[model samples]
Target: MNRSPRFRTSRTLACAAALLCGAQGLSAQSTAPAAPTAGGDAPATAVLPPVQVRGHYDNDIGTSDAASEGAVTQRLIQNRPALRPGEILEFVPGMIVTQHSGNGKANQYFLRGFNLDHGTDFATFVDGMPVNMVTHAHGQGYTDLGFLIPELVRRIDYRKGPYFAREGDFASAGSARLALLDTLPRPLAEITLGQRDYRRGLFAGSTQLGESGVSLLGAVEAQTHNGPWKVPEDQRKFNGWLRATQRDGNSDRALTFMAYDARWTSTDQIPAALVENGTLDRFGSLDPSDGGRSRRISLSGSTRTTLNDGAWQASAYAVSSKLNLFSNFTYFLDDPVNGDQFEQAERRRMFGGELSRVWDVTLGGREHAFTLGLQARHDRLDPVGLYRNRARDRLATTVEAEVKQTQAGVYGEWNARWTPWLRSIAGLRADAARFDVDSSVAGNSGKASDEQLSPKLGLVFGPWQQTEFFVNAGRGFHSNDARGTTARFSPDGTESLDPVPGLAASRGTELGLRTVIVPGLQSSFAVWRLDLDSELVYIGDAGTTEPSGASRRSGVEWNNHWVLDDVGLPGWLLDLDLAASRARFRDAPSGSDRVPGSVDRVASFGIGYAPEGGRWFGHFQVRHFGPRDLVEDGSEQSSATTLAYLRGGWRPTASLTLAIDVFNLFDREASDIDYFYDSRPIQGGPAAEDRHFHPVEPRTLRVTASYRF
Candidate 1:
């Protein structure tokens, strides 16, 4: 019932598309090649900013020998609206987050045409502690991020791919490092009054408690909404965080106490018209008063100590999380008798802790950054399903599962500044993880554990201060649980479970170049190949809707950001940001190409205007996502989509400011999201190939006003 287009056929088509786009890009460039700016070719030396690991700025390029890129970047954090790091760089080149469940679905972003897998695609690190759980794929990525107020984040560095010493296992696609600043003081509050009795407000404050590095911090955000789909955003969010630390005057040996809480609840579900007709709200939706609620809370802390004559830093951290998800779903079916409606409830609690250390050892004239860390987590997931039968009898089935996993790794990276122009980092890690899953279901229940040794190596060459070339090779590993093949039956009473899902493993290689045309201009380009052999995705159970398989994805990405003609344009400045990517699968073990569901090729461009160091600013952005398949059945072709947004912001003084956010500029056609898996069977059968694209959200606008003192 399912006919797979030959790999060659799809690849040939992809190649043609890439060629066309490449030609168009070339045409867009000015007739004359860009001339090197004055002082752009400075000699490379200690004069240059340190070349750090992916997504890290404050952290030195110590022994953290990353498997891939070492592109040093500087991001301007001013006159911009950024709720989270993802917001500011959401439009960054070489990256995309095809999100679902609204923006709160923090973990559900897609990057480089790869699924965030909830939070598995990229792992976040604070200092040296891992924020993503070993049980990521299906669960929450932030886990308890709501508790950590984003307002407290000083800087965030995001990187994708290749292993390095500073990071550990599960850091496959990439990683992010968040550095929290304690001395900075930002106090502010804002309250908004809107239509449909909608109201929202936030309050935050931070101060240095003492010179020894003791600090106090607090923040809160809240929202409320009543929807008619006209002003369709009935949601509420709150976040609070506090911290205290004592450090030696030399900035070493620090003991810190950290605690935070984040909770978001929304009662607005995607409207019907908003899903199909992104441009119209023709008819009143079926249920305008229905929606969903999501809440998550977390708390943790860490202690860092310096030993061995200032040659080492050691730390231990622990985090706990609790979450709730409630959804009321209504939809009309076209098949198996049509007219189907449902509601579901899900609750989860996960708690764990990790300890990590970094030892800075000086051997002769070279430095070695050695890392040994271990993480243990206990995840208890409870999923309940309620179904209505043909006779209108409501039947309920519950799935209770508890999973405990312990992961520990040892890594050592040696970055040799072998020459003024060339540097190399070679590192290796040995990781062992064991999973214990206790599920109420019988035959599908079992325990599986695996250990792996991942090797990472990278080389960077700076021909000139403005240019750097790099290469990296590393392996990625993740485990899968056997939980989807339960006794829950479909509306048609089709039994599940044919082939048990297996574990997933990956290995990849990447090469890239980053350069600065000048202090204010930056650019990067990378080409990579990933070999993913996945039995079950990290986000879902194996052998569920679609069969799992081995897959290969390789792509090229180019990115650039420039503060063009800054001095020439005066108050009117033009900054350009561009991204382009293309992907092709050399082999898809499963006949279906949906093994990895993400857009194959995509691009985005943004132009902005702002006061050099003033308070008010705005930007106009154009985002384009190339057409691609999500379900591999009949292409599941989603037309390429484009969206636009604008903002008017002002900061009257250092402590007070206000702004407005307008999304879907022209009310472009957009989708909320489609159900990932259709009820269609996976085995070759009459129903095997039937699938539908989940609907997407419609044009929406949120007016925001803020003040800081």
Candidate 2:
């Protein structure tokens, strides 16, 4: 399929988005203030309280528009013993997070039967800053979560499908928003030690700003680790953040600054045949010098103020980040003499902002709400490049480019309660974007533009018997890499190529139910189907995404959160999540409809005990992901993976605590990640297709001590 710039369509959508923003701004000025309360004073807007770590579950049944939407509080995040920073996302039902290389790199994510390689179909945000990078050197929509400090996260709000008006690019499958804490109730100092030369330190505190109604919070962490690899990882990482917040009668405001830096050696996946034949160990590396370094710093601010019978919110952020990564996916396939090691590098700056307003009005003796929002973002990459390397030394340049990408969007939604047992929500969104690239190869330098308009609808019925039913449908999209949107030739200039569409569209529908029929238990189930206009696959050799055939995926999910209080165990909680999905190409021949790397089954079970005023707490968890096809013809497949984790802690006094964490508790010899591709394991050997895998780490234990003042 050939895709060209749609000038007229893009202009029309851009104008529509801009006009909607203007109209909403004008209407908001005429809204009247809410009436005074019984005490003859304006009511204060609801705000989230300060962060506290305890055994508490947030209730979302009565407040959610969809059964697949929920919030995870600090209680769950603090109690879980995460081996990697990105593991925090596992709290989302049916979501899997894994790593194929170094711990400091972006994680491999899978959800809803889609292999969301490096966050293509999943959008993520930290505070108000977007975490997905556009047109990155490594891949499209590359997301790195190493900068996040799990302890500082107050809550994580997640929604599945594209049924929300507030979400835009990269949100076809789902989205997550992480909110940070503004203050700490008590200052804390901690130290941790483990085998394999692991060590870490952390310090955090909060204080008032001289009675100015402003509070200042600061935190810093440093860590080092050497994995169980033949070549020690020798990872070093540092993270720090500072935030200042002020809350007045009807307004809230905050400013935050964050910085992160890391460097590490990676143990890339090895050929399975070699490992099986004893030519290489499971934890061995073909290239010892393969590694990466990254740096990120950002400043952001947000404000929320009461406006008439509603609220207004605004946020803005600026970020500067850089990455230098080196890898050898195909050791000697491309270059038998020098070995096929390559480097990907990028230096980029990003700026973005969002403005929104919500109004609550009564119509015909019924409650109704209307919301309008506008969002804009810009990214500038001074130099994004790919190079051929040998033993960490650059041998030649493949491609280099300077690119700029900009996007703007607007959405409006209306929600109304038709009756005591019936409700409806309807919404529409418009988005537009422009991509410009100046490449070293003149044939690949050009400009392109595109736009899209999407509609969303949801209906809810009946709380009869403590159960609610829902129906939802929506449209969403993800942008392709800027370089791919205008490229006319391959990086090596040896073959011609075709430019891909700037944006690929997706449509989704879901039928779900939420119930609390059993006391102390919350259960939800959803059956969903999603269709894509085009599936963009990552091309490792060219460092870009190439468009593939259209595809369809259907899945079912069951999530349960049970508190054992009513069962005579007041301090115990059990959680179980199960999902199964089928994915296939829409128009593929027989025996080739299967989508590679799409797992069909995922399950997780966790239990924890944390009673109020208790001196001891413990949590145990098990996770499993079923096998998947590795090729179109299903000629090869991957094995299933399962692991267990244990966490236990004791409080020695009111201000001191001790904890122990065990990962891979059963010593399972599973693989963290796997792939099937052509490579030459030995120099000057014939290229052959085989399985490649990164082995899971062996069982490990860590101990931590913390003091609060």
Candidate 3:
């Protein structure tokens, strides 16, 4: 790596000037004020202004329907070291985020024994807007968070089961909602530089509207990186955000706009034999042309009003996005002439809205709460297709189609407190969807419709000793890709295929406990099980639906958060989370029940120290992903992986801070993801079966500086 003396000097001077100005401001504020006089100015006495505390408690253990519901606040997000924006989801216990391709693509997510390919069973949202793309070209329920500006996040609320009436679709495994701050305490500008030619810049600010009860917030970000690959990644990205909020008494409304664009070259997974035989280095690529480009623009608005008894809320959003992905998974295997390269492309527009009302009442001397909600969404995708390509030129069109999808859902829930230590929640939801696809191949064009009714129930007992026990059960479902729902033939229109169900149902149950009995400690334990009606999915790569037997998964999770204020180490925090699970095909033969790629164990630990009025802060964290069977018969398995990270910061003044982050701190050699497959590297050669993997990045360091105005 080379250094730019001019850039370094400018940054240093800016930080120094900001710190100097901040110190002078602090000194002026510390000066004594005029004394207060009471009644005729007799013996005036100095009176200090009253201090107002501002900050909310972190919800490490939530008091909701399920023990798995919790929240991560800005305090934690600001202190953690994340190699990529999507890693923020790691705040969800037992959740692992890893990338198998380029930074521009959606990271692979695993949780509770489910691989959740590209956010399939796990739903994600940002500021009332959904991030998951339905009927996506790459995969169903595809989610990308690269557009997120982490500094704007206020909090992330997460729940690990489908036990709530407010959640629907792709939420069977879990859901996460990220909220952005409506205002900032001050304007800030930050610059970060790291190994492998990585650079990023961020600018954000907020201001009040004069006497209008309104506020405006704006942010912009630019980033570039050339990863340590045989062929440079050359990732470039830009993001922008704007929000306007109006507040009046107990009511508030906000309108937000966001935009993001990114382009990058990728190094897809490689054959293990190639690396083992020294034919290619771990950082080598099978195809240098593998890459992708994506963009998203959205506008959303939300409003809340306090009603006579409870509250009313509503939100709506519209988004437009485009994606062009090029991948070469098995070179010379499928198409020897074209080298097996393929492209997936799509252009889509989506609109959605949600409305809800909550009412509070007392019945028979007991308090009760009720909520009613409705949600609707629509997606119109044009020219979604798959094609064979050589280099970057398309050689043949496999499947090309236009799709329209619409969904409507409604639900109602009631919560009742029967006794001081007993509570119950019951809910029911109904959803209906319609899918229409017009394919370039006439035989595959068709329409399909489906509906489902889901019931939910939860019971809570005891707060005795600051511990609560919970029992929850719920039914949920995820919509299949529109193409899968209406397809009559394969991509080439040669082989006939049966259309899959429009919606696949899942049911789950859990028993859990949460405790805050120990001082400065919050902990939770949960044992859960889920069953899917069928393991059927639309394979984007092959452009067809594949059906499998029913499946079941059982898991246990334990999460703990402890603060060490009483141990003479104020502002020190520790977090530990562990999870284990078993996934099996319910209908499989006795000797082959194991589900492929289902991880059995996961763990994460973190420790941080950030004392009040101190000039320094530091954090260290470790994450582990245990091995798992690679096939239904359990003949092959993957090896476990562990990685560590360290972050430290020095606040020279109230308005200036410098930070450094070390990733893969121990220089561990590991794989981000792995799969077992057969491929032919040479024309007319016998196919070889082996484990394919994407190696994780080696040790890297990043330094950042921030100035506040």
| Candidate ordering by TM-score (highest first) | 2, 3, 1
Whose TM-score is greatest here?
Answer: 2
Candidate 1, residues 1-709: lDDT per residue as tens digits?
Answer: 1112122222432333333221101000000011110101010111111111122222122212222232223233333333333444353344554444433434345566565555555666553345665443234244224334444455555556745544554456666655454433346677765444556676766566555455555556665554334535445555555544445533332223344333333222333334345532432332332233445444434443444632222343444444333322333332244223333333445544344444555567654444444333445544322333222223433334555544445455554555556666676765544445555445435555455667877776764756777788877665444343222332234564442222245787888777665644555677887776653442222213343566666777766555544445433333333434433344543445553456666666665665455565676666666665656443555566676666676667765556675556787655433343333221132332232332333444556666666
lDDT of 2: 0.82
Off by over 4 Å in 3: 1-57, 60-62, 683-686
Find the 10 residues in a row with the least total lDDT in model 2: 35-44
**Predicted candidate 3 versus true structure: per-residue lDDT over 1-709, tens digit per residue:** 0112222322332333333231101000000011110000001011111111111125433345678877776777888889999999999999999999999999999999998889989989887778888899998889899999987777777888878777788999998888778887778899999999999999999888899977888999999999889999999999999988877877767778999999999999899998999988999987889999999999887776666776666677789999999998888888766688899999999977676666777889887778777667789999899988888689998888999988777788887888888888888988777788998876888877777789999888887788889999999988889898878888777888888877789999999998988877788999999999887788878777887778999999998888878666687888899999999999999769998888899999998877766788889999999987888898988889899999988989888889999999999999999899888766676678889989989999999998888
lDDT winner among the candidates?
2
Residues 260-279 of candidate 2 have per-residue lDDT tens digits of 99999999999999999999
**Candidate 1 least-lDDT 10 residues:** 24-33
- Clash total of candidate 2: 0
